[model samples]
Target chain A: MNWFLKGTLTATLLTMGGVGAMAAPGVTEDKIVLGAVDPLTGPPSLLGKAHSLALKVWQEDVNARGGINGRKVEIVFEDDGYVPARSLQSLKKMVEVDDIFALIGTSGSSQLAAMMPLIDELGIPALNNMAVNSHHFNPPLETLFVVGPTYCQELAAGMTYLVEELGLKDEKYAIAFQDDEFGDDVRCGYLAGVEKYGLDNVLELEFKRGQKDFSAEMLKARAAGVTVLVSGGVVAEHSTLLKEAAKNRMDITFLGAHSAHLTPVQALAGSAGDGYYAADYVPALTSLQVPGVARFMDLANKYLSESEMDSLNRYALSGYAGAMIFEHVMTECGEDLTRACVIEKMEGLDGFETDGLLGPVTYGEGVRHAPTGIMVLQSNAEDKTFSIVSERMEVE
Target chain B: MDYFILLTVSGIAIGVIYGLIGMGYALIFKATSVVNFAHGEIMMLISYMAFSIASSWTLPFWGLLLVCVFISAIVGLVIERVFIRPMLGQDVFSTVMVTIGLAVMIRAVVVLIWGADPLLLPTDIGDSGVEFGMVFLYTSQLYAIGLLAFCVLGMWVFLRFSRMGVAMRATAARETTALLMGINVTHVYAIAWAIAAVIAGISGVLLGTIYGLGPDLWTQGLRAFPAVILGGLDSVFGAAISGILIGVLENLSEGYIGQGLKEISGFLVILVVLMIRPYGLFGTPEIERV
Candidate 1:
């Protein structure tokens, strides 16, 4: 048994060495390997799985189109489970072991922050569509290009639409946010909305993550006579807050960050989720009116399994768009494909379109983030879907 | 005044759930002198089990409760026999550590079986609530409070009259003395685990109904820890009352003080209560022979 094990290890090492000798890092003559780190196993898997599925669909489609410069694209996904330390470790393994040329599907803001130094150290060109934090772009790295607006930008734009377009500036506004960096971003937008519109700031409440009950918070909101509520929660918390409000019979206009644009939110929130506004960077998943969404759905149905097709949401659209952008950079690099060449193309990218999936993306010169605009969506409880209620509005 | 009443009522409803879970901890600690750290995981597993069952068939609330209780009791007995029975004569700390390990294993297994999605437990009562003037109560909240009362009454009767219950009490008092008195200490331990598991199962189902079930549901067990400490780790009745007290205190603190005071209010009460009465409100003072 010991001899057999030793022989297997020796053979594996020989194979790895042979592969290393035959190719440049993450790029063989016929294959260009890419890597992704996402929260694939824990609570955040809802987003991560869709992210991976989208990448898979893109990979299949790109390969079917005769690959990028005759090199079949291969993507390796690592599950970070939404932990920052794990995200760092996953990126290190992807760089040193898998020798991935570029990275897509970065984890949450903090997780990506943990992996930022490693990404810079390795000089790996990466695209981030999931988490768009201000810190990532404030002092930009050489190779990381971010798409999508930050939560602050999304919320601020949504609030702007509510106050300016909907004419609810005089209403008593309040914010219920989680006590974390994500919550802080939401608060930044809420403050911006309040300052811009001169709305009555009635109440501001911060809750711990994973807090199941919001009875007291709802009571306080009621006590303050809050007419407009900014829900600063994601996923289950979004549904939970709405549920509590429904129970209290509080009749208030509700708005949520982009994360609340999920079908699960509407399903979980049931009747209460109806008519709630959600701010997002991308077009609605069920928005067949959008040409990009129609194309994505057609490709997704052809490539993804039935369950995978059903699981397709806004994250899938973002992930597909991110992958599409990366594909374009790889295509532009052509036969002289290298990390430096890819980065060069990415930095010069401007007016990049996703065929209406998102607003035109542009990153050039010192700019690291693009598509800093948001569209407001309203939930339709009957169909468990969101409809675009506002055109793309940029946030300063 | 309406806000206060609403907050207090809701707090009491949640406090009843805390008490229900705390009783499971106290029951095991009383019998075996070891904390069942996996009590919350047991609650979580049973709740998930209930979720699965409810998904397959539409059982009335009472039928669902009975099914969960039966399945949970069996799981409890099996766990005790497999994990706790072998460590019976060893240091009590070892048994406690075993429970902690069991907790981690249960959490992993649960996540494996049921993916980490927050699922709503479908029931006949769907977001229906009754309003008495300004005070409104969701049916699930009212059910939780009523069920806690029923369980407490049932526990009192069982402890006061049943032969097995008396045997459990005897075993808890002194293991060797109870052995000499012809009480099967091992049987008592198994019974205690089964009863505790039933309590946890019921509490978990009610909680899942109210707040939706997710992987984080197990954390509520840890949240109930303060209630057991304040009520007296060995006092079943005390745990129930303290659970309500903690719940009310937490809500009142959050309602009045605002911010995120609700999460810490229970611990603050536990700290003060422990400082004043080291043995807890109903726990017997231990007179150790030096």
Candidate 2:
């Protein structure tokens, strides 16, 4: 009985030592675990699924290459279902239960906002590429690293190109936007373009989100003689607007934010999506001309199944780019990777390139968001693909 | 003038869809005195079913519509039996709550099967619009208007002349009394649901063709609610007319006022109309003695 008691004590001490040697939270000698919260079950699952697939591909690639500092990386995903409260709860669960070292795949603007307090409290090094809302960075959190420009900046840049470079300055401009923060951001860009180009701002309209019918809005645009329309709709609304314009026989040039750079938009809009300009921060899915996109497609085909491959869109590229940036930061931190170390390295990142997937990412002290350059893309309705139509326009 | 004409035409097109769905709501409520909160989900589910069938087979528009209507009727019957029939003796609120739960479940099941991505529904009618001088109309829009008219006319004829329709009306007026008079109230309830589902299915498919099919398509049912209230909750024909009136009013409001008033215009009308006539334009006023 004495020998058994002594042995049990020794075993317990050894277990304590083993647990202590695991280094950081969610970090073991052989593995580093990360958390992702996204709308995985609702209408926004398209974005979340693509994001997860990209992360999965990146994880596979990193593990194959011995991971960061010889530790395999893993991601645990929680579905927020696009609800802000759910996003907060999912983040809480991931932090408390999963013990994630870093966070990625923060959902929409409101969702990310909901998780911000928890992220700050936990000191989680988070990379947000999905939503680059300005509020998230106005008083930047020390550990939050934002990639990509805000919709305002993106659309503004795209409009600049349309007016100055594409020679749409003479056309009557109109804005049909959703009445929300996202729409307001897009409208800011539209207003900027109108002011800079001294163009005719014929009409500015707002519609409710998830509105199916846009016939009245299109008719209103037609009445205003809008020759160049800036569509501030996200995914489905963009297609609906185009369809309405087509039905109205309104000969107009349409422009959209980064969300328009999707295969689904082109597919849904059918012939109406032809020649529509979409401003994007990342190279398009079909922009295989870029080395980064070519490599991504190769990796995607290799790692993802046939259906998963079909699901690849701009979101996938952005997610992969984000994962690549995280990997860079982690690689730079070497074997001494703590959440603080990752954040420190991320803040010091300069001209980090995704091999042309995105503009050179540069972040420094006091800067949370790296205003990456924007590219304008045009959809070919026949093939349901978008091709880069302009050089990357650097936004200040 | 062209803009007005365009707005009016477009409003009528959307209004017809709203009316069709509203009619479904009215029919069910009239027969069972219990609102199927799943009316929108039924519409969305049927549309998705139609989408799946359309994707897998090469069927003309008419053939696809027929198939969807038939399938929707069976779904309605099943829903009535499995969910509604069991709760016949329960409180009306409980039955309504069940339908609300069923709505969420149907939405989940749809997302599970088709995923969250919105898909373009292929149809026989192409994207080209008919040019009526200054006014333009999509082929789908024209079809929607025609279908709404056809359904409303058929419903009117059925209720006025058919045996089952009269039985349903009797059952709706007084369930126990209808039962005493040798009418099977359960059968009438099932038939009402089936017909309502068929109407909703037709509207859903039309809306799908016009707007594309997505999980959020169920919200269209909610949008048609104002139509139902304005037309009288239990008056199918009144709901049909109110749906169009609300649609036109919404469009005109958006066209002129233009500050996102289109969505609220219908509800505003409902409020004003209800304030003046609580029973709606065509609804039967109920009387009680305490």
lDDT of 1 by residue, B122-199 (tens): 777867878878878878888888888998999999988999989998888898999999999999999999999999
CAPRI classification of candidate 1? medium
The digit string of per-residue lDDT tens for model 2 on A83-140 reads 9999999987886678789997899899999989878866889999888899898899
Model 2, position B269, has a per-residue lDDT of 91
Please give the distance, in angstroms, between residue A186's alpha carbon in candidate 1 and its true position after superposition: 0.7
TM-score of chain A of 2: 0.94
Docking quality category of candidate 2 according to DockQ thresholds = high
TM-score attained by model 1: 0.95
Give the lDDT of residue A351 in candidate 2. 94
| Candidate No. with top lDDT | 2
